[model samples]
Target: MKTGKKVVILLEAVLAVLVLAAVVLMLQGKNGQDMVKVSVIIQNSDDTQWAAFKYGLKMAAEDQGIEVYIANTGETLTVEEEKSLIEWEISNGADAVIVRPVPEEGAEEMLKKFEKRIPVMLVGSTASKDRSLSALPVTESDNYAMGTALAEELLKDYNNSVEGKTIGIVSETGELESVMNREKGFRDRLLNTGIQILWSVTNRSGEPKENLPADQPEVNFVAALDNNSLTAAGEEAAANNLHGAIVYGIGHSTEAVYYLDTGNVKCLVVPDEFNIGYQSLTEISESLRRFFHKVQDKAVSHTVLRRETLFTKENQEIIFTMSQ
Candidate 1:
């Protein structure tokens, strides 16, 4: 009888231990059930311009043991489209979301609605038209400073004799806060240089080349503020369509680097997109691990590359992130 009683006691103890384990897992929540999942949304998610940025995201995701999904999106997205995409991400089991916001009307309301449901991290640029909207954390470069650097390089090339140099400006949608800041920075640097800005245009329809008409007026230089604009200007310059304007601009793609290598572009300012990816995910992962952790804004740095310095050991590291 005592032996039978002992067997019953052992069974009960094992059952109790299993029950406690279940309770602990339940208390741990979804995090205990599976790995943390994150989704990313950006404009033209497959574009070559995002090569380095995506590479950074991959490295960070591996390091943090987090699952990341880069949503396929078109070249442009309306605020409504962004809302839908973000909602899909949350509904499909995303513990966190990172997005390059669509700069448009009604963006603030949309972001607020979803931010309450999950942690929303902003990348590339802010979604608000106000430009001062900062309720969420952002990871990007000092666009204004990048612009200043580009102008400084231009000034250096001309031996500070750029007082009367006529210039044309080109960029992606002029509405983006990043793009606007860069233009502002570049213009501010030349505010006292007596340089003439002949024309400035944007590609609202995703076609950078449209800004460069065959009969475009001649300018001493062309300042492109994004990869698309820089590449378009470089191609046009190579074909003698930019009226022999020397190309100086900010870029982040293999094609842009190629242009600089072949002497089609004068100077290239490359923002630290890899760090932007790594740091954004790193912050997001940390927040997931700790409930009250606040991720601060990070303004990544940039590097100025000339053709002669493109193959240096340090620059090659940047290129590997961008191309490989």
Candidate 2:
């Protein structure tokens, strides 16, 4: 009888352990379903352009009831660092990932790996060569169109006459596809305008007032391709009193607006950064819900912000609030 009793006790103990294990697993599964997690990784997180984008991400995350993890690499990022962060996110059970990948070798392979694990929403430039990743959903401005538009606007000042006129092009880096495209668009648009490109210099170090071309003839216009170049060109123009030369560039920062107000910059091509952030998160959320089968590919539109329109009541409020 004691032997039979011992057998029964062992069976009961085993049953209890199985029940406990099942309950623990059930709890873990429930917790996993309760909250969707997303990770957003950005290169150059210190840039002011990301402020609106971050705000938009937070707002969308709160609205969607999802947890967000943000990783900002303060400097230019590399492929290895990007892969490490992505692996960490995957291990942490991130449901989706939004990243602005640095253009480098193996970027395409890394993105393919990310797509296999979780839905990826790209921002800024498409880091892939051959445009194979063009089908991926991305939130970015039409940089080429922005450059072309800026050139068109500049030409209006000269009454469409480019004869005997020189234009200087300043940019951050040639390594970036966006910068290259913008410069290319601008140059191509002016190909038949009889205007001369004084020089195109890459100022990655961002030295203030040092972006201007040396030994160049008097430039009728200066085209700064990015925010840093824009500021540098503006400062140089202001300090040198180049009032005859119209300086313009692409940026949406308060400093860019300040340059406009001070007559340092003539026109600014501003992309809706807030929309980019908001749309990226919203799309990621939808992708998570729908298994990433329905996200659409599109580019955010760019706006030409002149001084008159920039200081308008609505724009003024937006600029003030964004600066804060």
Candidate 3:
């Protein structure tokens, strides 16, 4: 009788241990013991503009049981340089890669070739706006829609009576597809509105080549088309260098937010960069887990912010994500 009782106790303890182990395994998912490796490459990866995006990636990394590595990249990357970096990551045993593509000719083709070896995804701008964009998996907001929205906001401010308003357009560079598309959208919306575009300046990312005249001689407003340009515009406005022209543009960064908070920028259109980072990582992890699963293009949303609405519940959440 004593021997039989001892055997029964041992069996119960063994079953309990097995149950606990199963519970842990279930909670940990496929990465209970092994971690999937993913590498991210971005041009100027260290830029603060990527803060929200990086935050999202970090959250997804914890949830999806993957280890992520973002490569140290330069201010501008060439096609050959990007290709070499991808090759190196693969050789270093990266299970997948998330890349911010260099907007150059032949970049898409290069990425597609890497796709064959491992799962690949894109964040932010694609290589081109052609049919090739559909061929690659990407996460980003609709740049064209954002530009149109900015124009709408500006028009609303003027009550659609911009007939006497003269404006100058400032952009990081007139070359980037994003910048060009935004300019097109903004211009298309202003067609027949009688708003005079006095001048359009490109190559104003960092410190301007020349300071904007603070004297109101020709323009009534200055529109910045990208983050760097918007921030530059805001700085000029704060310092009274933009010639009292109202500042407006699309931006995503702490500095941009600071300017908006201080009432320098008239309005800001920000892409949901957090969602871009989170969704991209989640999709890549899903593909790694399920080989048959195919990731598709995800169009994230954007929000137009003004100083008064900057700290609302919803926008505050967005600000938090970007700041942290």
* Best first by lDDT, ranked: 1, 3, 2
Give the RMSD in angstroms, all C-alphas superposed, for model 2.
7.5
Residue ranges of candidate 2 with Cα displaced over 4 Å: 1-33, 129-135, 205-218, 241-245, 292-294, 317-321
Off by more than 4 A, model 1 = 1-29, 129-131, 205-209, 213-215
Q: Which of 2 and 3 is ahead in TM-score?
A: 3
Give the higher-lDDT candidate: 1 or 3. Answer: 1
Model 2 local distance difference test score: 0.76
Window of ten residues with lowest summed lDDT in model 1: 24-33
lDDT of 2 by residue, 33-150 (tens): 5788889888777777667678778888999777898876766678899989888887987878888867677776777677876788888666664344454567878778888988
* Candidate 3 TM-score to native: 0.84
Residue pairs in collision within model 3: none
Which pairs of residues collide in model 2?
none
Q: Give residue 167's error in model 2 in angstroms.
A: 1.2
Write one digit per residue (lDDT tens) for candidate 1, span 1-324: 699999999999999999987665443235454888889999888899899998899999999989899999988889889889988887888888888887676776788777776777888776664457667778988888999999999999978788788998988778878898899999999987889998898876454446663346789999999888898888888898877789999998999999999999999999998988998998888877765676678778899999999889999999889985
Shift in Å, residue 108, candidate 1: 2.8
Q: Assess every candidate by TM-score.
A: 0.89, 0.81, 0.84
Candidate 3 Cα outliers beyond 4 Å, as residue runs: 1-33, 131-134, 204-218
lDDT of 3 by residue, 1-324 (tens): 699999999999999999987765543334446677899998788889889999999999999878999999877787899999999998887888999877677888898888887888988776665635446788888877888999999999989999978988887666555677788889989999999988887664333365343433558888888887788789989998776789888988999999999989889999999999999999998887765688777789999999999878999999998888
TM-score of 2: 0.81
